[model samples]
Structures are given as C-alpha cells and as structure tokens.
Target: MSMRTYVTWAEMITGFARSGDSVSARRFFDQVPTELKNVVTWTVMVDGYCSNGQMEMAREVFEAMPRRNFFVWSSMICGYCKIGDVEEAKAIFDRIPVRNLVNWNSMIAGYAQNGFCQEALKAFGNMQAQGFEPDEFTVVSVLSACAQSGLLDVGKDIHNMLSHKRIKLNQIVLNALVDMYAKCGDLINARLIFEEMTERNSACWNAMISSMAVHGQCKEALELFCRMEKSNEKPDEITFLSVLSACAHGGLVDEGMEVFSKMQKKYGLEAGIKHYGCLVDLLGRAGRLREAYALVKSMPMKPNDMVWGAMLGACRIYMDMEITEQVAEDISTLNSSIQSGNNSHYVLLSNIYAASDRWEKAERTRIEMENEGFQKIPAHSAFMPCGA
Candidate 1:
C-alpha cells in the first residue's frame, strides 16, 4: 500500500521474471494491492508474460492496465516480434502514440530475425526518416537483415554512412559488418575487417570461421578456429559447429573426430544433434559410411531429421542401398513430421534405389511416401539481385 512496498514488489516481480519464473511473478503481482499497482507495476507484469511467451497473458495484463507507458507498448511489440507475428508487432508499433529508439530497434530485429529482411530494411529507413539516429543495436539488426537478404550494396551504404558520421564501431556492429560482408560472398572485405579488429572476442572469431566454412575455405576456417583458441577465447557450441563443418568439407576425418571428442571430453559441452550430424557428414565424406551409421546408432539423444538427412545424403553418395534402407526403417519408427511434408529423405532414398538399378525398390519407396501423405517439395534456389 505504501510507496516503499510498491518498489519492493516491483523489484521482486522483475527478479522473478528475469529468472523465468513467470508464475511467481504473476502471483506476486496479484498480492500487490490493486490501488498500489502503478503503471510501472503493470508494465512489469506485462513484460514478464511477454518474456515467457505467454502472449495471451501478456495481452490480458496489458489490456487490464489502468495506464500504460512506452516500455509496456514496446514490450508488446517485442513479444509479437519474438513470436514471428510481425504483422501484429507492426500493428502495435503503429498504435504507439510516440515511438522511441528501443521500439524501432525491436521492430527491425523482429523482422530481420524472422527472415523478413526487406521489411527490416524498410523499417530501418522509416526509423531514420523519423530522425532517430541508428544506434549499435539498430545498426547490427539492419546489417543482419542485409546479410540475410544478401543486400551487399545496402550494407555498404550503411557502412559508408557510419564512416561519414564518424560513429564509433563497437564489437557487435563490427561483427555484424563482418557477417554482412561474409554472407554476401565478400570474403575479402570480411577478412579485412576481421584482421583489423583490435578486440577479437569469441563472436568475432565465430563470424570469420563460419564465413570461411560456408565459402568452401575449409582449411582457412580451421586455421582461424585454431587462432581463436590461441587467443584464449573459449569455443562455444557455435564455434564447434563451424569447426566440425570445416573438417567435414575438408575431408579431415581424424581432425573432425578429435574436435568432436574435445567438445565432450575437454570442453564438457554435450555434442548436440547438429554436432553429431556434422561429424556424420565428415565421416561420410571420407567414405566412412559404416562408421557414420554406427555413430548414429550409438548417439545419446534421438537423431533428428538433420542427423538422418546427413546419413541419407552419405548413403546416396556412396550408393549404399543397405544403409539407405536401414535409415528409412529408422525414420519410419519415429513420430516425427519428417514424412509429413515435402520429404527429402524419401526422395533421396528413391533416388538412391534408382541410381543402384533397383527400379522396383524406388517405385516402392515413392508409393510408401505417398501412403504417408508426403509429396516431393520442388527444389528451388534463392534469387539474389544483380551486383549484390
């Protein structure tokens, strides 16, 4: 009822929300006297629900509020964006009486993160047009959009604008720049920026290593990863994934195995399904199909579509119908939706069967896929703009 109690309740709710205990936050919020619930308290409750992905609860809290602030409005926008409901986020953004930089950044980030690169770029333009100077978060989000859409020219323009305005590039902005350049196939520029950075954090190293692996510079990627370790930066899951991918591409079987072992043994990071998939791909590329299959069988966790997909791809490459059939049987046992959509595994199996001169088996596979209600998804390629 008092101002002191109000402040304490607000802080407690915030702490609970930050710790992912939305139930406690809501309970605590309910205990606070209705008369004591200020706009800040209401906003915190709304934010807690939003952070926990309980949009219905968030909206209920938001709608029930006697008063709303800029932060609550921004939280709603952010919540919608996080859940990939950009249309709703945009609606909320449009309804804001006045928007701030945080609101604008949240909108751009939502669009970019959910693969709406063009919308993100458009929103970035709108924000700048409204005279809100792009901050580090804004710059990074916009650059990520550029990277996702391969808008190299647009990214270059942003970089030039930053240079023109003499804005100090922080680590995140620099990393975004490197990512944008690298994803746009401008490895030269990406590397140049990477080499010039005085403060190379784990993220900076990850950007370069991933870029190199993606562009088929497997040897260079591995070398950069080694340099990352020598600089005393600890490799996280992303770092290992990139390193394993590089080994797979380079056909470095021994190196890949060592890295895979090091991940679990030395670093104490569990090798996730993706790491297992990369290792399988590595072994498969090296004509170690049986070993790959054995590893899959021995996995601690259930193999997902990616892991199985990697195995199937290897089976197809080696024309190993035996393993292919086994993979098909294994996939059939799972309650996954792998067979419910445009099933690549089924198609791969049919192709493998046909490739091995087993037309009947191939036809049988197709029939089975059809029975499972899966149609082949047409292959498509992404279209990049000219000179991008």
Candidate 2:
C-alpha cells in the first residue's frame, strides 16, 4: 500500500480505538504491513485494548513491540492501573529506562485509585527529585491521594505548588481541590474555592453539596443547589443524590420530598436504588414509618438491605416494635435470598429487639448472628487538614 493508504488505515484504527471497538481495531491491525506499524499505530491499538478493559490483550501488544517509547510504556502501565493491577503497574514503572512525567502520573494515579495514598505521595516526591515537573494530571492524582489518606500537610503543599506554578485551575482540577478540602473536613477552605471559582460545572456543585450534606450542613447544601439551578446548570443524578442525602441527614423531610418528585418530573430521570434509599431514610427519620414502608413497597424493584436497614433504624428510633418485627422479617428473608455480605441488617434488627426490652428475641437474634459468623465492624475516624 502507498503511504497515503497506510495513513488512511492508521486513522481508521485510531477511530475504532477511540470509539471502543477494540475487536475491529485488532482486525485492522492484522492487515497492516509490518513496516507500517509505527509507534503511533501500536500506541493507539494498545490504548484501544486497555480502554475496552482488555488489559491482557494490551500487554500482549506492548510486549510484541520491537521498540518501546515513553508513551507506549505509560499506556501499558496505565492499562494495568485502570484494571486495579497496581503492583504490575509499579513493576513496569521500576523497569522503564526513560520514565517521563506521564509515567509518574500514571503510577501515582494507580496508587491513589487503589487507596495507597502514602505510596502515591512517596512516588510524587521521587518524581520531583528526578527533575520531572508535575503537570495538572500529576497534581490532581496527588491531591486525591492526600484527600483519601487525610494528609492535610501534603495537600496544603500541593495547593501552594499549584499557586506557585500558576496552573490554570480548570473545572476538573478545581473540583478535585474542593473535594480534597471537603473530605479533609475543612469546609472553610472548601467554600473559599467555591467562592473564587467563576465557572462551576455539575461536578463542582455536586462536590460542594456532598461536602455540606456529609458534614450536616443541610441548609447550605440546599441553598447551593438552588443557586446551582439559578445558574442554569442542570442537575444530574449525582446532584439529586447529594441534595437528597443532605435532606436525609438534616431531617429536611419536605425539601427531600419536593426534590425527589422534581427529579422525576423535571429532569425525567428515573429514581435509582440510591435515591429510593434516601427518600426512605428521610421519611423513617421523621417518624413516618408507614409512609416509608409504603414508598419501599411502591418501588418497582425489590428493596435492598439499605432500604430495609433505614426502615429498621427508624423503627428502633421510634420504638415501634410492631413495625420493627415486620421490617426485620422482610430484611431476614431478603438477606437469606440474596446472601449479600452486609451484617448491618442483622445488627439493626437485634438492636431494635434489645431497645424494645424484648430480651428473649434479642438474645435469639444475637445467637443467630453469631452462628452465621456475622460481626459488627467498628467504625474508625481520621483527621486531616482542609488545604495544604
């Protein structure tokens, strides 16, 4: 084939890869002449495989390459990272003769994705020591790692670096920064960034709303949701979930109901299991046990453990033993049928029995839990600074 024909084939392969048609891309690759399979062609093919979740195929292509460059190396490592193979990705990183900024970013991102926050931080330090200037992707990955690990000091250092480097804070990076601060429980700094951002996307709004909701700032979350609507940005499923969660947490029963209804009517988005759970929790918390049970029954799909647990919690709070028994029996039946590993349902049921002064029933429930090897996992807490 002529050079023009080769270029045309290469473009076709790239398009197929981008569209996630890896099978077609592979077929196209099979037709390419050995001489025409350049770095770009191979990289695109490998990326296609990786993006399509065929990491094993991606590795085969990576190994078959006669010569490897930084992009190829980074692509393969990123494939491993994407599939949660962090150890293999790190092993590749250690062996690369010419590691670049992209290589470091890919590895750090993998570590962060796998919750190895300390290793991600250590990798970032090592990248800087090796004279590779961290880019926006690098900063985002490290900030996320710091957020998950609750490394306030390290998060602050990264924020300062962003300012020092004069990196333009785009929506993605800004949202990550806000999320880091929010996760670290520094609402002050989180709000500061929210205020300074002249442009906010759905993700930014969602992050802020979630931060407020999780921290019991229901009023603020609702106010922000209103402001978000006023700005003409549409709320997606994530946005509604955050607002509903805020309402559930703050006991904003009326607000929660209004939002839930609006989600279906205005946005035309069907209520998923998460939204249903929030609504049930909101009603149950407000002593509307029957309403909550009615909502659960009305759901098109069978209620999950979370929905049942929410009802049980409400019953426990109101000491409604009559309803508690019904909900507990439903939960027990569902638990037996689905075999979901959530022990919280059993614990909640037992707690309800104990709270209602039904000693024999509570002891029987405890015995049942023990026989099934169900144990209550202790809750753990951590503290991190809001911003570095």
Candidate 3:
C-alpha cells in the first residue's frame, strides 16, 4: 500500500479504538506490513487494546514489538492504573530506561487514584530529587494524595512551591488545590483559593460547596450554591448532593424540599439514591418521620441500604419504634451481602429498642444479627502523613 493509504489505515485504527471497537482496530493493525509499521502505529495498537480493557492483548502486542516507544510504556502504565493494577504499573515504570515527567506523573497519579497516597508522595519526592520540575498535572496528582491522606503540611508545601515557582494555576490545578485545602480541614485557605479563581467550573464549585457542607457551614454552603447559580454553571448531581447535605445538616426542611424539587423540575436531573437519602435525612432530622417514610415509599427506584439507614437513624434519634421496625424489615429484604456488610443498620435498630426501654427486643435483634453472620467490624483510624 502507498504511504497515504497506510496513514489512512492508521487513522482508521485510531478511530475504531476510540469508538471502543478494538477488534476492528486489530484487523486494520494486522493488515499493515511489518516493515512499514512505525513506533506511532505500534503505540496506537497498544493504546487501543488498553483503552478497550484488553490488557493481555495489549501486553501481547507490546512484547511482540521489536522496539518500544515511551508513549507505549506510558499507555501500559495508564492501562494498568485504570484497572487498579498499580503494582504492574509500577513494574512497567521501573523498566523505563529513560524516565520523563510523563512517566513520573503517570505513576504518581496511578498511586494517588488507587489510594496509595504515601507511595504517591514518595514518588513526588523522588521525582523532585531527580531534578524534574512538576507541571500542573504533577501538582494536581500530588495535591490529591495530600488531600486523601489529610496531609495538611504537605499540601501547604505544594501551595508554597506553586507560589515560589510562579506556575500559572490552570483550572484543574486550582480545583485540586481547593479540594486539598478543604478536605484537610483548612476551610479558610480553601475559601481564599476559591475566591481567587477568576474562572470557576462545576468541579471547583462542587468542591467548595461540599467542603462547607461537610464542615457544618450549611449557611455558607447554601450561599456558595447561590453564587454558583448566578455564575451560570450548571449544577450537576454532585452539586445537588452537597446542597441537600447542607440542608440536612442545617435542618432546613422547607429549603431542602425546594432544592429537591428544583433538582428534578428545573434542572432536569434525576434524584439519585444518595440525593434521596439526604432528603430523607433532612426530614427525619426535623422530626418529620412520616413525611420521610412517605417520600421513601414514593421513590421510583428501590431504596438502598443507605436510604433505609437514613430513616433508621432518624428513628433512633426520635425513638420512633414503629419506623425503626419498618426500616429494619426493609433492610432485611435487600440483598444478603448488602445486609451483612452494613451492621450499623442492625445496631441502630437495636439501640432504638434499647433507648425505648425494650430490652428483650434489643437482645433479640442482636441475636438475629449474630445468626445472620453480621459482625460489627471495629472502626480504625490511620494517620498517614504525606511524607511517609
């Protein structure tokens, strides 16, 4: 085939791969002459397989290649990372003969995304030690690690470094920065960074709103939601979840109902299970147990354990034995695995019984829980420093 035809075939391969049709891409790939296949062509095939979750096939083609490009290596790392196979990604990273910023960033992001915050931080330190300057992507990944681990000091160090280096904070990096500060309990810094942003997207708005809501600054969270609307950024499902959470926390029953209505009617978004749970919690907290139960019954989707758990929580708070019994029965009807995993529901029901001076029922509930193989898993906390 002519060079032009080969280019067309390569483009077709990419097009197929991008459309999640890796089989077609492989058909075109196999048609290419061995001598005419370049590094770009090889990389595309590997990437296509990886993109389609055909990692074994990707590795097969990768191994068969007479030569490897850095892009191919990065694709392998990214593919493994996408599958939560970070150990294999690290193995690929360790094999890279000449490491670049992309390689380091990929490894760091893989670790961070997979909840290996400590490993991500160690990789960040190592990257810097090797005289590589972190770009926006690097900063964002490192900040995510710091946020996940609540490494406030390390987050501060990265923020200071950004100032010293004068790196132009792109929206992604700024959003990550805001998220890091907010998650680390530095709401003051979080708000400051948020205000400094000249352009705000949904993610930035969601981060700030969620942070405030989680920290019991319900009024402020609502205020920020208002600002988000005024700015014309469409509030997605995540935004509404945060808004509903704020209402629940603040006991803003009327306001929460209005927001919940607006989520479906005005915004044309469906109220997900979590959204329903938040609204249930909102009403349940305000001692509107009957209304909350009615709402749960009216939901189009079957209420999950979370939704039922929220109802049980309110029952526990108000000592409503009737609703507690109903919610507990509803929970028992769910999939056995879900029921077994959430012993908190059983515990809450038993507590409500005990609180209402029904000792026999509480003991019976405990015995039932034990018979169902529900063990109350001990809660634990870990203080994982970013530098670790």
**What is each predicted model's overall lDDT from 0 to 1?**
0.86, 0.84, 0.87
In model 2, what is the error at residue 336, expressed in angstroms? 7.6
Every model's TM-score: 0.91, 0.85, 0.86
- Model 1: which ten-residue window has the lowest total lDDT? 377-386
Per-residue lDDT of 266-301 in model 3, one digit per residue for the tens? 999998889999999999999999999999989888
- What's the true lDDT of residue 82 in model 2? 81
lDDT for each residue of candidate 1 in 1-388, tens digit (9 for 90 to 100)? 4455678889989999989999999999999887677998889999998988888899998988887788998899889888878898888889888888998988899999999999999999999899988888888889999999889999999999887667679988999999999989999999999999888888888888887888899999988887887787899998999899989988989988999999889889998889999999999988899999999999989887788788988997888878888887887788344544547676676677777778788778767767876655323212112342
Number of backbone-clashing residue pairs for each candidate, in the order shown: 0, 1, 0
Candidate 2 local lDDT, residue 117: 91
Better of 1 and 2 by lDDT: 1
In model 2, the clashing pairs are 156-388
Q: Kindly report the root-mean-square deviation of model 3 from the true structure over all alpha carbons.
A: 5.1
Please give the lDDT score at residue 84 for candidate 3.
92
**Residue pairs with backbone atoms closer than 3 Å in model 3 (clashes):** none
The Cα error of candidate 2 at residue 135, in Å, is: 1.5
Which of the two candidates, 1 or 3, achieves a greater lDDT against the reference? 3
